[model samples]
Target: MIKAILFDYDDTLVQTRKTRYQTIYKLSEELFGTKITEKEIDAAWGLPAEEFLLNLFGRFSSDIHYLWSIYIEFSKKDLNIPHLNAFDFIDKYKNFVKFGIVTSSSEKVVLRELNELRVDTNLFLQIQTSDHTAVHKPNPNVFEPIFALLKKENMNKEEIIYIGDSPADYESASKFGFHFLGIAHDDRHTSYFQTGEIPFVRNFLELEEYLIDQYSFI
Candidate 1:
């Protein structure tokens, strides 16, 4: 029945390259006293921010809490909207199904971008962020809370699908037995398609069409 669709917000909903560039550069300069290049930051984009920080900075004595505070403050100010177009078909179908955003980003950053983009908050039944779940993508624990939330609404796992732009997302969906849609075209997303573990679409337009076709039978 696929009563709901869960989305990954960063590279899936909006382009992530520029936002990563700005946030990484600003944080590196402030924390390390040196500017890190975009190329370096891009390499760390798919992983958790804290893991990325630790990898770059090593285990510093400073509490992770302080580092995250700085990262969030920098990200909020630097976030930029990328070239985005509405999945018009999905927009049309919204009334027929539930939708939500599940991302590795914090709620603050997600809310800020949603507000800036003027995406209707009412469109999503739930917004699950990394902060809400102790485990991030590639970890089934993150999906557990989402399932619990949806179960409370009488939704079954079979009646949901997850769409995202990374290999970790594909792995998460597989672990949870949810249909996975991998967003290809971006280099960051190519691994999912190349592995052929999940179906892939080039863009939202293609995804919208695929969904329309797939759901027509129902």
Candidate 2:
């Protein structure tokens, strides 16, 4: 009786790690004349934007805004197509449960990518982003807004699922009382969930199967 599903936008819904790595690589080279390596980016992956920058540069500066602008422009060129039948998955389950986007990304970034992918935003019951919440992931309060929304719909916490790709996503959702499903896209993500004994699926096809078989959604 899962009544709602809250999705993490970036790595979960769309394939963004490469695009993000490229953006950071090019930005570092263009501005600071430093070439950031993929290994470095991977280490900082899934961190909040500011924290990601801090982890990379080891310092905070006004240039973070400049970097963000360039990142957004680069992202505009990246289409960031939905991963593994994500649009199809949404369409298939929209009637079965309320769909929402609960992400640590800003609305500006999320909306642009969603538009570029041609996803029908109307299909979601809500799209809550970092801009909509005071705190971000790893902080359980980040889920309060959506939790409240579900409560208003008379949905129980046990009946809501939050699908994401990072340990932080799982931590926050589980702490906030929602079931969490990891959407592991690579060995790194896979290992994280496996180590934590968390349930996950590699792609939307697996997700579709998991939902039907485990939840009797069919």
Candidate 3:
């Protein structure tokens, strides 16, 4: 009876690591006069952009802000990356259920990518961006507004599930009492599951199978 599915935008639906890592590397080089390796940036992937900057530099400064601006500019110039692909199962079942994207990314960039990819916005009942809510992921506040939108549309919480690739995504789903499907194809996600707090799958194909099994029981 699941009526809707909420997806995380970055690593969940689209391959964003390459672009993000490259941007961070460029930023690091510009701000610190040193190149940041992909491994270091990858380690900091789940953090909010500004927090990631602070974590790398140890303090906030004008140069960090300038670098961020440069990264944003770079992100805007090109949205295409080599490995980007929508989840195949989701694409196949696109018409079977309502869909939405919930992410901590800025609305501008999210919309830009969605438009670039030609995602059918009409399939979604609601799309929540970090800027639209007072709190970001790992906090229930992000889900609260989404729930309100669902309730207004007369949808039930039990009829929804959230799929994401981060531990924070699991935390958000747990806080909102939504079923969680963890996507762990990357090392960052694999490392997160080592803590043993949640169950995870290697990719969306595994998620498709897991959902079929879980729903069969319901």
**Top-lDDT candidate index:** 2
lDDT of 2 by residue, 83-170 (tens): 8888898998788789999887777888888887788999888899867877888999998888888899999999999999888999
Per-residue lDDT of 8 in model 1: 85
Candidate scoring better on lDDT of 1 and 2 = 2
Tens digits of per-residue lDDT for model 3, 100-177: 889877676777777787776766777788667767788866888878877776788888889888888988898888
TM-scores vs. true structure, each candidate = 0.84, 0.90, 0.80
Q: How well is each residue in 1-218 modelled by candidate 1, as lDDT tens digits?
A: 67888988877887766576777777787777886776666666666656766555554435677777777777777766643454354467678888888888767677877787777777888888877877888886778877887898898878889988888888888788888888764675576487775688887778877787886513
Off by over 4 Å in 3: 30-32, 37-44, 49-69, 77-88, 194-197
**Order the candidates by TM-score, highest first — what do you get?**
2, 1, 3
Q: How many angstroms is residue 50 displaced in model 2 relative to the true structure, after the best TM-score fit?
A: 4.2
lDDT score of residue 71 within candidate 3: 65
- lDDT accuracy of residue 190 in candidate 2: 88
Q: Give the TM-score of candidate 1.
A: 0.84
Candidate 3 local lDDT, residue 36: 75
The collision pairs in model 2 are none
- Model 1 scores what on Cα lDDT? 0.74
- At residue 25, what lDDT does model 2 achieve? 73
